[model samples]
Target: MLKDLAIIDYEFRQILLAVTIDIEHFAKIQLLDKLEQRGEDGYSIVSSFLESNDRCNKDGSVSNYVKTEIDRGKSGCYTNDLVARYPSYDYPVWEFMELIPFGTFNQFVQFVAGKYSDKKLRNSFYRLQSVKSLRNACGHNNCILDDMKSGRPSYQVSYDVKNALRAAGFSETTLKTKMSNERLQQISTALYLHHSSASDGVVAAKGDQLRYIVKRMYRNIEYYEKNDVVKSSFSFFKQVIDAWYFNDD
Candidate 1:
C-alpha cells in the first residue's frame, strides 16, 4: 500500500512538471504576464489573493508557497542549477512552475489553461484536481484504500475519464457504481491523467512501476479473495493499467 501510494505521488509530480513545462512552451506568453492582464490592480490583486486565507480566492496566487520556493532556489537548496540562474523574484513561468507546491501548481495549470479555448486542456485541469488530492493523501501518509464504499465523493467523476474507462471495457454501470467511492474516483482519475497527459517516456516508466505494484498486490491474492471491496478495487485498477499501458492492441 505504501509503495503504491509512493508511486502515485512520484508519478503525479513528474506529470505535473512535464505538463507545466509544455504549457509554458505552448502558451507563447509568460504566465505571469498573462495573469496580470486579468486584473485592474495587476500584481497586487494577484499577490494579495495568493496570500489571502480566504477559501474563495479562486484566482490563486504565486506569492505564498512560490516565493518560499524561489528563496530556496536562490539559496542553492535545490539540486537543479537552473533555479539558481534566476537570482531574483522575477522568475520565468517555467521556473515558477517548477518551484511551486503541488496544489499551487495545479491551480496555476487551471489558471493558465482557462486562457485558451481548448476544452480538453480545461478538462485536464479537473483531472489534475483529483491527482492533487491523491498526491496530498500519499504525502501525508494517509491510508488511500481505507474506504471503498460508494456515495461519498465530493464531486462527480469527469465525463472524459468515464468514457475512457468505458472504452477500456468497463460498463457504464460499473463506472457509475465503483467511481462513487472517493478513493476509487481519485485513484482512477490519477491513472487516467497519467495515461492521457504524461510524456510517452514517463508513461512507459510508470507503467513498469505499476506492473511491479500489481505483481506484489497479487502475490497474496488468496488473502484478499473473499474481501470483495479490496478484491474489486484492486482488480479495477489492474485492468485499467493493463488496458492503458500494457496493451499493444
Candidate 2:
C-alpha cells in the first residue's frame, strides 16, 4: 500500500498538472478574446487590474505574482558571470493563470458569457477549482483520502465524466456510488479532467496505469491491512478501483 500510494501520488500529480496547464491555456485564450473584443490594450488593462487596490487578494493574485517576479529580477534571481535570468513569461499564458486566484476563474466564466454561447464554460471553471484543490493535495503529498473527505469537490460527475466511466464499463448507478464517497471523489475528478483535457490515447494509457496499480494493490492487500490507517484508506479506494477495473455492467 505504501508503494501503491507513491504510485498514486505520482500519477495523480501528472493528471493535475496536465489539467491545470490546459486550464491555463484556456484562460489565456478567453482573456485575449475579451481584450480584443473590448478594443483594450492587453498589457495596460491587465496591469491595471493587478495594480488596483480595489481588487481583492483573489482578484489581484496575478498582480502579486508579477510583483514577485519583479522583485526576483531586482534581486538577481540567476546572476552569473556570463548569464542573468529571472522568472518571466514571453507570452504569459500559463504563468498568468497560475497568478490568478482559483475563484477568479468562475467570475471570468460569467464575465465572458456574452462572448461565448457555451454554458459549459461555467462547469469547466467549477471543475477547474476542484482540480486546483486536488492539485494542491497531490503537489504537497498530502493524504488523498483525507483531503477529499475534508474538502468539497468542485464539480459533480458530469456527462463528460459519465461517458468516460461508461466507456470503462461502469453503469450510472455504479458511477454514482463511486462518486458519492468523498474518499473516491479525487479519482472521479482525475478521470474527469483526464477525459476532458488529455488525448484519447493518453487517457487510455492513464486508465490502464490506474487499473494496473490497483491490481497490484489488491494483491498486496494483506500488507496494507497490517496498519489500521492504511487498511481504512485502502478499503475506501479499493471499492472504487474494483468497480472501475471489473465492471459487471
Candidate 3:
C-alpha cells in the first residue's frame, strides 16, 4: 500500500506539472488576453494574483505562503539540486510550480483555469481535488482500506472518470454502487487521470510498479477471501490497472 500510494502521488504530480507547463507555453496568448481583460499585466500572473488578495492563507496572504516556500527552497535544506535551482527571490510560474506543495499547485491550477474560462481545465481542477485528498491521506499515513462503505462522497465523481471506468469494463450498476464510496472513487479518479495524462514512458514504468504491488496483494489473498469488501475492492482495482495500463487498445 505504501509503495502504491507513493507512486500514485509522484505520477499525479508529474502529470499536473506537465499539464501546467503546457498551458503556460501553449496558451500564453489566451492567458495574456484574459489578463489584459482584467487589467492585469502579462509579465507575471502569479504576482498579480498574489497582489489581489483573492485567497488568504492562515499565516498571512497567499503571497506570504509563496514567499515561505521560496525561502525554504533557498535554505539548502531541500534536495541539493532543487536548492541550486532556486530563483533569487523572484519566482516565475514555472519555478513556483516546482517549489509549492501539491495542495498549492491545485489552487494554482484552479486560478489559471478560472482566469481562462476553459471548461476542460476547470474539470481537471475539480478531478484533481480527489487526487489531492488521497495524496494528503497517504502523506499522513492514514489507513487507506479501513473504511470501505459507500453512499457518502463530498463531491461528485467526474463524468470523464466514469466513462474511463466504463471503458475499462465496469458495469453501470457496479459504477453506481462502488463509486459511492469516496475512497474508491478517489482512487479510481487518480488512476484515470494518471493513465490519460502521463507520458507513455511514465505510464509504462508506473504500470510495472503497480503490477508488482498487485502481485504482492494477491500473495496473501486467502487472508481476505472472507472479507468481501477488501477482496472486491482489490479485484476492482486490479481490473482498472489491467485495462488502463496493460490493455493494447
Candidate 4:
C-alpha cells in the first residue's frame, strides 16, 4: 500500500507541476487581454496568486514565493521579472493553483481548453481544484480510500474512476467489496491528476509499474482466499488494485 501510494503521489506531483508551469505561462500571455476585458491591472495579476493570500500560510507569514517576488521588486523589477519569479518558488502546485482568484482561474481554464481543444484534459476549473485537494491529502498521508478506516476526510469519487473500472472489467462481486463499493473515488482522483498533464511515456511507465504491483496484490488475495485465511485489510487493498485499468494508449 505504501509503495502504491508513493507511486501515485509521485506521478501526480510531476503532472501537477507540469500543468502549473503551463498554466502560469498561458496566464501571462493572456493576462493583458483579460485585464482589458475586466479593467484590472498588473497588480491584480500578482495579487491573484497564492503569494497574496494571507490565509494560505499556517504560520500567518507570507509564502516564500511572495517574499521572493517582493525582494526582486526592491531591486527594480520589470514585467518579465514578475514572470521569472513564479517558476523558481519552492511551493506545491496544489496550493499555487488554488491561491488564484476563482474568476481569474476560470478564465485561465477557458483559455487552455479553447486553445488546446484537448478533449482528454478536464476543462472545468473546479476539477483542477479537486485535483489540488487530492494532492494535499496524498501529501499529508491521509487515507484516500473512502471506506478505509481512517480519520481523513472522505472525498467524492471522480467519474474518471468509474470509467476506468468499466474499461478494466469491474465485477458485480468486486462492486460489493469495500475498495470498489466505496466508489473507487481515491483511485479515480489519482487518475485524473495524472491524466491532467502527464505525457504518454510517463503514463505508460507508471501503468506498467502499477501492473506489477497489481499482480503481487492479486497473489496475496488468492492465497488468502484459497486457504480460508482471515480476510485481512489487505483484501481491501487488493480490491483497489484490481480497479486500476489505466492505459497510455
Each model's TM-score? Answer: 0.69, 0.54, 0.74, 0.43
Q: Estimate every model's Cα lDDT from 0 to 1.
A: 0.63, 0.52, 0.66, 0.45
In model 3, where do residues sit more than 4 Å from their true spots?
A: 1-42, 54-63, 79-90, 247-249
lDDT of 2 by residue, 1-249 (tens): 557656665665564555555544555566567556767554444444445423346555434544443344444434221123313332232334444455554444544453455466656665556666666665676656433323343446566655766766666665665566554665565545654555556555555656665565466667656566555445544554455434333
Q: Residues 70-103, candidate 1, lDDT per residue (tens digit)?
A: 5665556562476666554444454455666566
Which regions of candidate 4 are displaced past 4 Å?
1-123, 142-155, 171-183, 226-249
Select the stronger candidate by TM-score from 1 and 4: 1
* Candidates' RMSD to native: 7.0, 7.3, 6.4, 9.4
Model 4 Cα displacement at 51 (Å)?
11
- lDDT for model 1 comes to 0.63
Q: Pick the candidate with the highest TM-score.
A: 3
Q: Please give, for residues 90-138, the per-residue lDDT of candidate 3 as tens digits.
A: 4455445556666666676678777778687688778777877776666
Backbone clash total for model 4 is: 0
Candidate closer to the true structure by lDDT (higher is better), 3 or 4: 3
